[model samples]
Target: MRLLEGVLIVVHIFWLLSFLFRFNAKVKISTNLVAFILMMIHFEAEGHRWQMGLTYVLFIFLTLLILKPFIQRNSKKVKLDSENKKKVKKFCGILFILIYSISSFALVIMMPVFQLPKPTGPFEVGMTSRHLIDESRSQNTISKQEAREIMIQIWYPAEVTDDNQKIQYEAFPYEEWSGTMEFIFSFPRFFFNYLKYNESNSIKDITVSDQESKYPILVFSHGFGSTRMQSYSQMEELASHGYFVVSVDHTNDAGYTKFPDGREVMNRADAYSYSFNIEDEKDVKTRSRDVSFVVDQLTKINKQDSQKLFTGKMDIDRIGVFGHSYGGSTAAQVLLDDPRFLSGINIDGPLHEPVASSRLKKPFMFILDDDYLFLTDEEIKYTNVTPEEFREYHNKITELADFHYEEGIKNDTYRLTFIAGDHYTFTDFPYLSPLLSLDINVDQFHQVMNQYILAFFNQYVKGEKTDPILLKEKKVDEFYYFETNIKN
Candidate 1:
């Protein structure tokens, strides 16, 4: 809880106790005064949100009760018979305590505290978001605009400082962003109210760490209909380990994107229409272009004098691209199309038609969820399909997976599947809410994921091969399957 919130809770508890115990008039008035002051402070801090409605009502009632002592002093002095009066006071006190305790507990649960996992790497992370427009390409079916636009947030190693304040995880206003997500997912807005207070470990636009002369660049693309902030845990972890990570929000496709000029782009009907209508191949191809454009812009930033944050610090020659879901397919497409990216990681996303058939020569990794690799026969069958059609569909998907595996064997590639993983496991959604995740332990899943991602990048990009975790054979309890084509 925030400072004022804690104060308000404490003061309310004290006021309730004073009322129950029949404290002296001075003590009751003093407690009420302190609670009222704290209530006003909390209002100033938290604003007039419905979450604080109970606090407001409680304050008003307490104020009236405290003032009643003075107004009814002469008339309220009626003394009852000792035995009945004592019993009545005892029962009322117990009831009041029970009611107050439950109410307080409920209120706290409504606005629960949530936290991001701390980065285990040695260096601290700093981040900045930039708005980039690709004038060379026209807008897709989502927007009728002339140029394709994207918002890219970059996280890099930063010098740790005591004075630096941590940044908020979402790029847009917390309430607005949370509301947008609720609208898109059709959940109640209050379901995500706790997200507003979840702050990132990253500081905004701090000085890049000079521990190394240059850092490898890794670009991240989010799943379809997801914002760049969705994979913040992974990005921050990578950035802390001396990689300059860039996450792109494809405008109109992201859940909600806010540009510097206050222009808000939402994932509306146009965006979903294209996603649902277009072929996965075309969708990923367009997204790949966005990644390539981002690489080009980053190259310019590395070369140009005007780019302040990363001019001489970025190792343009050593670049990697990785993504989740549709974005994972985008990463593979980027590897196929752009020679600038040295490696790629595709997390739980199926390979599209042409890309599935093509061979990739660069070092690559495919982190699959168990369901992606082991779909049941019943799951593969369409509701209206004949036996032959079901067979064809199953064969087609299996062939794509087989081709991807064959390509992995031909090049330096790694394949890993988590036994308890599902599609959402590859992203941070599993860590955010248990209701949205598989039945597996989210913390363990995240730990294993971060370990391997860091190891892969460290070995391939930074040429550090000291990660022992990646060299071990797959343990059945930890992974459903694991394979690597690269020879040690």
Candidate 2:
């Protein structure tokens, strides 16, 4: 048996002793609280809580049934054999304790056997993924505005096991605006503490196999108020298909981030509010420059790493950028500013505010939400702009960009039209939330999404036409819808 299971069994015994002693309410509450924490830690498998809750209910029922006869016999205050009463009490205690301990132990043991299945697919392996942070900039003396240095994570295919190097957890602070994420406004600070214990903190290094093959560079930008880890499914999918994908976290823009030293940086929503017009433009440009800087750093890693793990593996010339929401706008902006980025993909972002003024000379595609029209229609119609400004901004790139709409297909992507599902589906929250099951079979969605994303990069970056699955316009999976316009 595992050490955790043994400890849980011992805890059960202590709880039984407390019940027999008629422990104070506070003591009983504390013991139950400990049990709750233990159960959550070992809940490696999903749906375990309901199973455990059911067992607890049954145990309480049986305990009451067994104790009723004893209580009745003792109520008469009549003489009874002390030995017989002691035996009866002991038997009840042992029986309840045994049942509780056995149930908990068996659940822990059987978790691995009943683990959820992974997605079904074919993928190659030459990917490397890693998170990079400039810790020096996170110091308190630095104003959040002045803190241009950021935490960026790049996922790529790699073949080296530098075991001595440590892996880091998906460390984001939930304290500042956790309350805002859900409509129920509460203290964001308290949510930080709650989130820590709930999340799995396992840190595994960027693991990839066979480092010899060359792969193209792909830069990724996550949505607003989200950390770089939010799109991990897409990152891993691309890495597994033998491409180097780099993801960046715009500091202060993400919900919150906790460094290795336990220093927590919360979202500076106040700062965003103060200078919305100027700062938003400034920040997006900064993010684009950060992507360029990351590419430069990867070049350095190729030459300097003692293990020579990165040598000849980075295809510096063949780079691409893709992002969602605010990130999607950033992707387009980066492609416009940096000629090094060969192709670009944007997943459902408003073009009017961020990229309306920018013109693109390179190829770019848009994987738009059917709801993009709802998002932009009002602003585009009402916002005042000079004719020259509108023409120079909106009309410059009208012919250069392509749109692919995910609408009206008999699949999960079509069902995504139900507002809450659309924005969250592309994010890691889909996998994290219990509500995911209510919306769609998440595993199926992940499988189809991964396939198409990889196929797009493969065709554009590597000049290879692979995965004909994306060529179809009709629904093949209930998890997605398909539409595309190839720009002339």
Candidate 3:
């Protein structure tokens, strides 16, 4: 809840109480006046959310409370028996208060602008975004533009200066992508205007920390129909621990991506499609090329950044790659195709051909919602297919997944399976609303997630001692399953 919003709600409830308990007329009048002022200020400055709609309406009725005396003085009193009138008025008052109290509390709770937990590391986090176009690769998918375009958002360790407090976080992280992302918002974009009050832990575009001469670079790939901002919590956490993390938004596959020149790209496949499609082979290949292209661009940016943002601050040789869902497939392929990436992790993404059958020499890991075979009920609803079709789709995917899972574990690979999680569990979507993944164990999910994610990268990318981190384990009533391979 907002500051003035909570204050106004309390004052109004108190005003109502004062009237009910027959408190002093001065107390009633003063409370109403204070609440009125707060309502006006909150509406104008904090902006109104529909969650507090009734709160506002009841506040405006304060005038009616104050004018009751004048209204009676002006000769408009109901000529009724004293007992009957008192009972009627009391019933009406109680009913209205019940409706107001219940609805207001429920609505506000439904749309809280939750604060992201602070980064657990010593350094503060800073982030900046860049737009890159791969001229070498022609547009493989349907598009008006010729070259493949990519948007990279980088989060890095920042000097803990007064500016960290001075600078404010951007309320809507995906302001540029929101318009083209109508699928995420069933109503108009204004429905999310309340996000203006949302706060982020990482400050925007601050000076890089000089504590480390060159920070190890970690490349990120978001799931299909998701932008680079999806895993912001994980990125900020890694950045705070002195890692430079860059997340890529694959133009055609992202929910939406807007370039500085006003060009926008939307998802080529059905953004709402939850079921797996065989066509992912093309996507897996194309997005894998995207990883290599981004790596190439980073190499140049490290040598001579276009804007001097990362001039010599990148420990380019120590680069690692990781991705979610489809991007996870991309990450696996990139680790195989490009020797530049020392290690990689794929979060909740099924594997495809070639990589599914091929061997992995480098250290790798896979984090999944389950065995990665069957789709949940939500996915079935989103897919909306006949029984036969669903069976066929499930069969094909699981077959490939079985091979992919086996091949991944044959070498130095790790796996974490959240028995009760869904695809969004691997991302920060749960923080927006638990409704996104109803069955997810959010607290436990994050506990195991961050612990191992950091442990994996720290050990592999920076050569930090992670203590067989990839293969450490214990199970509690089958909540989650962890596996690691010790390849001495």
Candidate 4:
């Protein structure tokens, strides 16, 4: 609960106690004053919806309590003829207080203040976001702009602070981020209001830790209609572990992209209107280009004379790329098209025709959800997939997996499937809300994901020996299946 909300609740409790016990005039007045002050504070602070509503009701009740003493003093008192009548009045008052107490306590408990799990890495994390415009490329007509624009958030290892007053974990302060999500997903705005309080384990623009001369770069792309901050937990974790992670928000494709100049770009309506029928091959190509352009910009930033941001801090030669859903396909395409990225990971994203058909020479990993696990025709029915659609979907996944396996025979490759994992599991959606994900241990899922991703990058990018966890042949409880083509 917020500070003001907590104060308001305490004041309400005091008022309830005073009313039931028939406290002295001075005590009643004190309670009323405190309640009114707390309510005013809550109003100014803009408490949660339930908190605000309850506070208003409590304010009215307290006002009536304060006026009761005045009314009693002015009006003639009526003596009850029978003792039973007085007892009945007292019983009713107690019953009402009981009911109110229970209801108010329930409301307070329901006002949830969700928090992100603390990152387990040794280093603290710092973040900064930048808007990059590719001058060489023209913006798509749907964007109504001149240059291709992308918003990116970068997370890196930071100096840990001992000051308790220092505000770590910077996040969206208001309803803007949640409002954009509600707009894209067509959900009630209040459903995501808690997101405004959601904070990552990363401070804003802290000085980079000097433990390492340079850190390996990891580029992340979000799923269709998702913002770069969608997978914030993962990015923060990676950064805490000494990786410089950059997450890109593809303008006009993401749900919302707010630039430094106060301009906001939303996903194009036409794009979603024809999404189902249109193959996302072009979209994949566009995102691939975006990633390539970002890589080029980072390279230039590393070599720039005046720019302090990431100057000489990026090990461009040890860069890796990864993404979720459509963005995952973009990662694979980037790896295939550009030789800059040493390796790539695709999280539950179907490979486009170009990527599936072509052979990849670099190390790669494919993390899949239960949906992509091999299924028989009879088993396919349980997946809620129509026969025709299942055929095409199954074939595409199989072909891509086969190609990856074949390449794995010559180069390092890994395929992992989580039986309980869903498409949204690859991102922070599962951790954000239980209703948005499948029935699975979200924390465990994240732990396994982070471990595997770090292991892959360690072995490929940093030339570290493979971790023992990655070498286990026996099926672990978290995974449905795990396969690797790397020769021992």
Model 4, residue pairs in steric clash: none
State the local distance difference test value for candidate 4. 0.75
State TM-scores per candidate. Answer: 0.80, 0.61, 0.87, 0.81
**Model 4 / residue 423 / CA error / Å:** 2.4
lDDT by residue (363-393, candidate 2, tens digit) is 5556654444231434444445443544454
How much is 79 displaced in model 4, in angstroms?
Answer: 10
Stretches of model 2 off by over 4 angstroms after superposition: 1-147, 158-203, 206-208, 270-280, 306-309, 352-354, 373-420, 466-471, 475-480
Better of 1 and 2 by TM-score: 1
If the candidates were sorted by their lDDT against the true structure, best first, what order would they fall in? 3, 4, 1, 2
The lDDT per prediction is 0.73, 0.55, 0.75, 0.75
lDDT of 2 at 273: 32
Q: Which stretches of candidate 3 lie over 4 Å from their true place?
A: 17-24, 40-47, 64-78, 81-89, 137-143, 161-181, 261-264, 371-373, 376-381, 391-410, 434-444
Model 2 has an lDDT value of 0.55
**Residues 163-258 of candidate 1: C-alpha lDDT, one tens digit per residue:** 675544433235444645664566776766656666777878887998999999999988877778877778888999999999998776677777
RMSD of each: 5.1, 10.4, 3.3, 4.8
Clashing pairs for model 1 are: none
lDDT of 2 at 457: 70
